[model samples]
Target: MEFKPVTHVLFDMDGLILNTEDLYTVAFQNIVSQYGKDYTFELKLKLMGSQAHETAKIVVSHLDLPVTPEEFIAQTSKEFEKIFPDTEVLPGARCLIEHLSKHNVPIGLATSSSRESYELKVNKRHKELFSLFPYKTMGSSDSEVKRGKPYPDIFLVAASRFPDKPKPEQCLVFEDAVNGVKAARAAGMQVVMVPDPRVDESLRTEATLVLKSLEDFKPELFGLPPYDD
Candidate 1:
């Protein structure tokens, strides 16, 4: 299949470009374990790609936590920060970002992750690579956006950042989770689904293209040569 120009590229940070989801799962398990709530792997499958704050609400509801959503979010953020630095990108992430940056491709990060969590988790070394992207959008952009994943607010915010440029169809989203893909699709952006099969089987039916990993991401898909030799 022929890929388009891909003038703008929006990436989902946590699962797609970064390997932080494992940290989230472990931290969540820690939280639930404290309450004697068994958050099984199967249970975790339901929360992948969800916003951290929203995920906290779901977990609190599932486990019957005696805490408010605000408190749950605060606790989750604290714990997530403790484990986030250990999370880096999956294979080919560095190379792909570097290559895309070299060609002057417009890249933006659209994440449901909070700015504080993102800074603590994705700062420093990541900046060397992500700095070239020149755009950032987070879920905090809208207050009415309550649910994550199924909601398109984050992607819409990211797309709107390019107001002077291409239409929604001109921008493409790279997402690994089913919900992230759903959000991108809802925003009317062309989506390239990078499914983490271990976490997302349902996403296959919703994506424009499915790839095993970013290892298969080619610069030519955006009409550019492979960078870094």
Candidate 2:
């Protein structure tokens, strides 16, 4: 594929930067199992990159669980409190962020997680690494992001916040979900997807590039500085 050079970069949080998807599965399963329902992978694929309330609604509807979205969120929020603090950065995440920061490349975070959730996952464990981003757009909490993943709002908003206000084509997105890749493409940005191994091959066709892990990414391919090591 022919690639365009980009001047700015946006990143998705959750399964992309942090290993929180498994933790979320554990939390969601704890709730649905109480109602004799299972949280299946097919269902999880739909929930990935959705807003908090959106996710709760999908879970409640898909599993036919007798709980309001608000109620489900309350239950899962409690579960998150116990498990989120243990969130860990994914492989090559820190190295890539630091390399970009060191080279003065413009970067920002564009995540479907609410600000409160982001803090829980990163504040204590990965503050320095995350702080490298000049700004972040938390879709579930940011009023400016009127829509979640599969929509262009979050990535567009993230790019707009950059000091230079780069155009969508001038931005590159790093994501791990099909919805997120769709969002980036909708925003007219090139995206590099490092999806979970369990993600189906058919779902990866839309990304500008797809890799097994962030460690497999070649920044030079996108006009970003290469890692010194």
Candidate 3:
């Protein structure tokens, strides 16, 4: 399918840019298994792209765990603190970001992570890479974002922050979550989903394009400069 020319791009931070999904899985399994509950892929999909408290609530309710959302959040937050810093850039993520930046593309981050969590995940070693983004909208912390993914608030907010105030249709989003694909569509933007292999193929239909990895992305397809190779 052909895509409209895009003037700006917005990215999801967690599973798309960094390998935090694996760390999240380990943390979730460790907590849920303590209560004799299993963390299923179906449940993981539902929780993907949700904010911190929302994720905790889903885990507790879906797993029928005997804990308040607050308690679940506290436990998971501790585990995240231990794991998030260890995250590495996902394959081709750096190349794509640098390619876009080198071409003077307007790029921004739109994440469900709180500002604190985002920093913890990136500040130590990936600061230089993230600095390429002119702006970022952290749904958990940005007051202007009234709702998280599956809702269009965060992506819309990110687009509005661009100095050019590009129309939603002129922005392209790269996401790795089902909810994020929905959000981008609701925002009237084109989305390229780089979902995990375990994600069901049927769920990919909503995205303008779905690829196995950012390594498979061709910028020229989106009207952006092609990679030098």
Off by more than 4 A, model 2: none
* Candidate closer to the true structure by TM-score (higher is better), 1 or 3: 3
lDDT of 2 by residue, 1-229 (tens): 9899998989998998999999999999998999999998899999899999999999999888898999999999999999999998899888888989999999899999998999999888888888899899999999999988999999999999998889999999999999999999999999999998999999999999999989888999988888897
Candidate 2 vs. truth: CA RMSD? 0.7
Please, what is the TM-score per model? 0.87, 0.98, 0.97
lDDT of model 2 at residue 171?
97
Stretches of candidate 1 exceeding 4 Å from the true structure: 141-147, 200-202, 222-229
Tens digit of lDDT per residue, candidate 3, span 32-85? 989988888888899888988888888888888999999998898899889888
Q: For model 3, how big is the CA root-mean-square deviation? A: 1.0
- lDDT for residue 119 in candidate 1, whole number 0-100: 79
With candidate 3 superimposed using the best TM-score fit, by how many Å does residue 84's alpha carbon deviate from the native?
0.8
lDDT (Cα atoms) of all candidates against the true structure: 0.74, 0.92, 0.92
